[model samples]
Target chain A: MPAVTVRDLTRRFGPFLAVDHVSFDVEQGEIFGFLGSNGAGKSTTIRMLCGLLKPSSGTATVGGIDVGRDPEGVKRRIGYMSQRFSLYELLTVEENITFFGGLYGLDDRTLAERRAFALDMAGLKGRERTLTRDLAGGWRQRLALGCAILHEPRILFLDEPTGGVDPVSRRQFWLLINRLSESGVTVFVTTHYLDEAEHCHRLALMHSGRIAALGTVSELKNVFAKRAVVEVRTASPMEAVRALDDLPSVEKTSLFGTALHVWLRPGQRATEPLRERLDGLGIHAESLEFVQPSLEDVFMDVVERAGGTAA
Target chain B: MRRLLFLIRKEFQELRRNPRMFPVIFVAPVVQLAILGYAATTDVKNVPIVVVDADRSPVSRDLIGKFEGSPYFSVVDVTSNDGDVQREIESRRAWMALTIPPGYGDAIRNRRPVTVQIVADGSDSNSAGVGLAYASSLIAEKAAEIALQRRPPGAPTIGSIEARIRVWFNPQLLSQHFMVPGVLALLLMVITTVLGAMSVVREKELGTLEQLNVTPLKRWELTVGKLLPFGVIGIIDVLLVVAVAVLWFEIPLRGSFPLLFGLSLVYLLCTLGLGLFVSTISQSQQQAMMTAVFFFMFPMIYLSGFIFPIENMPAPIRPFTYLIPLRYYLVIVRGIFLKGVGLEAFWKDALLMLGWGVGVLMLATFRSKKTLG
Candidate 1:
């Protein structure tokens, strides 16, 4: 059985549906990523999967326990870390680890063993006495993760864990996540960064409380976004993008820094249509060529096609 | 049980580490004890008296000496002229004026009734009335002494009825004895309710509530764990207040210590439960504090008859005092402190407190569970 199986789960706050009929499955020991914008219901879905919230309709099971029926059973098998720092800032690093460990009913012997493992994993081994608030942002994030995993649950849910950390720290955190997955722990994480999503074994892109796409990164790139993207380098990038906006062959135009990224529909040749349009408008076109579509390109195309309504 | 202990231990650790809360938890109680001990009182003391001795005899001197010796009376001035007596009282130097008539010495020798005038400032009637009563009792004692000296040995006293008043507990009727225990109730309310709400709401603010909810800890265990530390603080506060009341304020704790401690523990559940209920309804620590003050603390303090007498309250509002847990607690504490009553006499109040504690805690626990869900 999958580590998590969510079938048509829905959660409503009053009249607003925060998670609407969303369904997905996460394989055991697989690193599953949920990607979306700020209010795209990623946290809501994760909360339900972690048994912190009860779904308004449908059902979900985490670690073979029904979330709606035996949420406490699901709770015993999963660990969750929120986007914000959730450990007691006034407590020492070791104290935080022990508190959470005890909450999971770990005995003293097992707690001591896990404490050593967690401290080493967080690179907070020697700073056991240091207050959590005194630690730097990256160190605090790592310590929070360490505390969450002290009980060594079968599954872990991280809701935007590396939100504000520096790039180097972000990469290190990802390495820790990869290690956890490699050790047979099913990891479900959410992030807005497309690069982080690429590291996941399989991911679901959510938009307006609905799953827009769910597949491997390469599969999404091949399936939803099959059209080629024309990268335009021009002296006047704004005028070049504006000139390409009205072209019959150009599907969409997006400006990335000083370059213009133009999407062409299937069976449309970007070489002839793009050059003719820009030359007619007297815009300086330095270069134009077809490029492989990134995950970001697939996401933008899917969300736009999904109609981007408010949840 | 071990999980609850760990959670409680963690709570104390956090409390100890917080620099701002250190003085609040420890030092504030002592300072408040000192302030409330001396300032809150109704026992009359040091009533300044002006004696106008027109007779200037030995008898008049004895009367002056009597007023000077009493702890309740301070003889501010002595003059032969009645006008000086009035001047002394009108100038606010004295609260009462005792005037001896011209024949006051002769009348006392003959065992006759002499009407000595005692003038008191009526503007502040409470203290002035008590002062006059003290003066009358002293003079009456002196007259009884003279009559005894003049009477024949073993002769029957002429047609008189002597009524002796033996005041039982708190003979002096010192207000500190009353207010010290009352202040303890107020202190416990502030700590358990306000601080309790702050503790719970603070977890929500820090987003730790989300982390806690995902743990295997049961809901009631979590609630009890979050509240057990404050309950310990409440017990410590009770002990501190009791020590201050007995040692510093000199108010005797005549009842059973175990009884007082046990009853206080039950009462704490009501306050802490109220605190949890406040946090459930509030979204932030500030909101929790305000709700604890306005919604929980104010109504409980007012209707508990801590500062006001329940009987004197309006007919419409009097019955609501029964719903206040502090009302039953105050009765129990005061009974244990002054009257030395035990479970036999106050078993009903104890039962009511238990009922209120269980009822409030269950409701709060339900509300918190719903809020979390």
Candidate 2:
């Protein structure tokens, strides 16, 4: 059975449709990534699945329990953590673990066992007495994850959990998430980081309260398969893009750092023509070559097609 | 039940670690009670008076002697000039002035009624009114005494009726006796209501409330867990302030201690409910504190008959006092402390307070939902 299944789940706030008829399914022990920018209905959908919000229409089931009808039953089977870490800053690491465990109604013996496990898992075994506020961002994030999973829940939902963390800590946090998934705990996470989305087995790119694309990384990259994306390195990328925009074969152009990626119409090749055109415009092009599209290209393309500004 | 215990334990742990909370909870009540206990009295004493003895006759001097002898009045200056009375009063030196007109002694000896003029500063109207009443009563007593003495001994005394006034509950009429219990009620309402609101809203500010909403904890469990600690603190404050009232102020707790404590518990339900209600409407601790103080606490104190008598309030506003839970609590607390009355005397007020408590609690609970929406 799937760990989570959402069908036409919609949430409305007054006249605003925050999550509009969204649907998806996550298999057991899979890392499902929901990618979107700020206010793209990522957090709203997570909240509904976690039983923290009621769906305005449709249904969602977490661990086989309907969220709208039996939110508490769904709550019992899932662990949730957010970007804030939500640990009491005044409390010690051990106390937070014990407190969350008690909240899940863990017995004394089980609480002691899980307490040691959480301490070891978060690398906080030796710093059990340290206040949560004193810990660095990485440690606090891990401690929060440890607290959330103290009940050994079958499903875990992380809402922008790596926000405001250093790159190194984010990588370390993802490592812990990988370990949990290896242990057969389904992980559902939302993030705007394209690089982090690479870690997920499957990803849904949300745009304006709707899923713009849902597939594996390679499958999503297939949008540029028939078309040609040529990367051109030039000193003046802005001038190069403007020079290539009027060409019949050129569909669109986007600046990629100092280089520019030019998209051509399907079954059309423009590498030689683009170089010749830039040379004609008195713009020096160092290199021009057809390259594979990255996830950032996919996100921009998806959002542009969905008629929303890309973040 | 166990989850509730954990939540309560977390709340207390947070409170202990908070540096400002310790002083606000444990020390502020004692300090406020001590300061307000001595400063909030309405008992007027030692009204300074400038006596103008224009009539240098023996009878006039004897009346001036009566003013000087009374404990209520201290003659700041005795002069023959009647104009000194206005100057002394305008300069704020004397609260009242007693002027004796010329030929005041002959009028009295002739058995004719003579009027003595008294000018009082009405800026401080409460003390001025009390001082005027005291002066007139003293003069009437002196007149009666002189009338009895001048008559021949056993010469058919005329029948007269007199009132022997006796003040019940407080014989000395000490304002502290009434004010101390009122302060106790006010302190409990301020502390518990503000603390309750701030505690919940603090969690909201820290984002922990959202975190808790995702947990399997029931809504009522969360409510009871969050507010039960403050209720405990409220009871402790009642005990502490009651001890101060009894030991330091010497205000009698003539009623049963358990009964007082029990009624205070019911009153706490109202205050804590108010706090919860504030949390539901506020998004931050600062907003919660503001709402609890300006919106809830101020209105309760003003309308509860704590400082101003509800009876003296405008007729239309007096009916609103019935809605203030503190109004019922003040009656219960003062009845216990001064009148030594039991449930038999204040059953109606107690029942009303309970009704308000439960109604407010239900309203607050209904508004406090586990779902974010």
Candidate 3:
């Protein structure tokens, strides 16, 4: 059976529909990413799946237990962590581990074994005596992850778990997550970081309380398979975008950092026309090259297509 | 139950690491007891009095001597000028002024009735009222003595009625004895209620509460674990403040020790439940503290008969005092400490307290369950 399954899950806060008719499923041991901008219902959906919140309608099951019917059973079978890395700051690393282990009702022998495993996994063996508040953000984040998994559940839900960590620590944290997924632990994660979302086996992009797109990275990039995306870099990106926007072959134009990404119509080539247009407008084109569509480009296109403002 | 232990242990560990909590738990109670115990007294003693003896006679001097000799009144000034009496009272140098009129000695020799004026500073109403009563009783005693002496030997003596009044529980009417026990109840309420609310709200602020909600721990387990530690702390504070009251302030503990402790536990249920209820409504520790103090603690202190007697409170507001848990606790603690009364004397109050305790706890539990869900 799939580790998690949701069908038409909906959550409403009074008049605001936070998660609207969301449906998805995650196979066991797969890394499923939920990506969205702020206030896009990613966290709300994750909360519902973890049984922390009751859905306003529809059904969800985690580890074969219906979340709305037996939330306690679901809780016992899954581990959850959040962006805040909610470890007790005043407690020492070892004390936090022991406390979480005891909270999971682990036997003393199992607690001891799990405690050692958590310490080793967090690379906190020598620093167990340090208070959690004294640790840097990276260590604290890892410690929080370790505490969440002390019961050795098969499914883990992480909500923007690496929000504020340094790049090096974020990479290290992802390594641990990948290792967990390889050990037959299903990982369900939500993040706004497009670069990190690349690590998921499959991803669902949410927008305005609804899933805008769901697929593998290459499959998502296939929206541009028949068309070409030309990068235009110049002194004035806005002027270049305006000049390229008037061309008959160009479907749409978007700014990507200092460059402009110009989408061409299917079966149409605009490289020569774009250079001639920029030269005719007297706008210097430093570099104009066709490039592969990045996830960020796909995100913008999908959100714009969904008739909502892209965050 | 085992999960509850872990949560409680975690709470204590956090408290131990907090440097600010030490003073609040240990030092603050002692300091408050020392300061408020002495400052909160209503016993009137050494009430300074200015005497204006316009009679300038031996009889007026004798009456002045009577006032000088009383422990309750101190003769601050004795002058023939009547104006000095008002000045002394207005300046707050004396709480009372006694003015004896001219011919007071001749009138007394001839057995003629005369009036003497007594002016008192009523700004401090408690001391002034007590001082006036003392002066009136002293003059009455002197008048009785003079009438007895002037009566001819075996001349038809008139029988006079006398009242033999004895104050029970507190023989000397020391306000400290009454106030110290109430302070114990007040301290327990303040500490347990405020700290309990802050502890839970702190978790909410830190986002740890949301994390815990996802765990397999039951709701009752969470509530019990969160409040039981504060309850234990409340008991310890009861022991500490009671020791200070009995040993340091010399207030008697006339009832059973176990009864006081057990009753304190019941009172703690109400306070801790209030804390839990406050936590449910507050989003941060500051909000929780404000709600506990301004909304709960202040009202309870004012209406609980801790400082003011319930009998003297406005009738419409008296019923509201029934809602304050500290009200019943003050009665119970004072009964145990002063009256040496057992449950028989205050079983009704104990039952009321139990009702309030259970009702509040159930309300708080229901609120917290809904909030968590």
Chain A agreement with the truth for model 3, given as TM-score: 0.99
**C-alpha TM-score for every candidate:** 0.87, 0.98, 0.98
lDDT of 2 by residue, A1-311 (tens): 89999999999999998999999999999999999999999999999999889999999999999999999898888999998999999999998998999999999999999999999988998899999999999999999999999999989999999999999999999999999999999999999999999999999999989999999888999988998899999899999889999998999999987789999999997578887898888999998999999999999999989998976
Task: Please tell me which model should have the higher lDDT, number 2 or number 3.
Answer: 2
The digit string of per-residue lDDT tens for model 3 on B1-373 reads: 8999999999999989999988999888988998889999898888999998989998998888899899999999999998888789888888899989998999999999988888889898888899999999989888888899999998987788978789999999999998889888888888889887887788889988888888888777878897788888887898899999999999999999899999999999999989888987898899999999999999999999887899999999999998988999999999999999999989989999999988877777676642234
For candidate 2, lDDT tens digit of each residue in B214-253? 8888888877897799999998999999999999999998
Model 1 docking tier (incorrect/acceptable/medium/high): medium
CA lDDT of each candidate? 0.86, 0.92, 0.91
Best-fitting candidate, scored by DockQ: 2
lDDT of 3 at B106: 93
TM-score of chain B of 2: 0.97
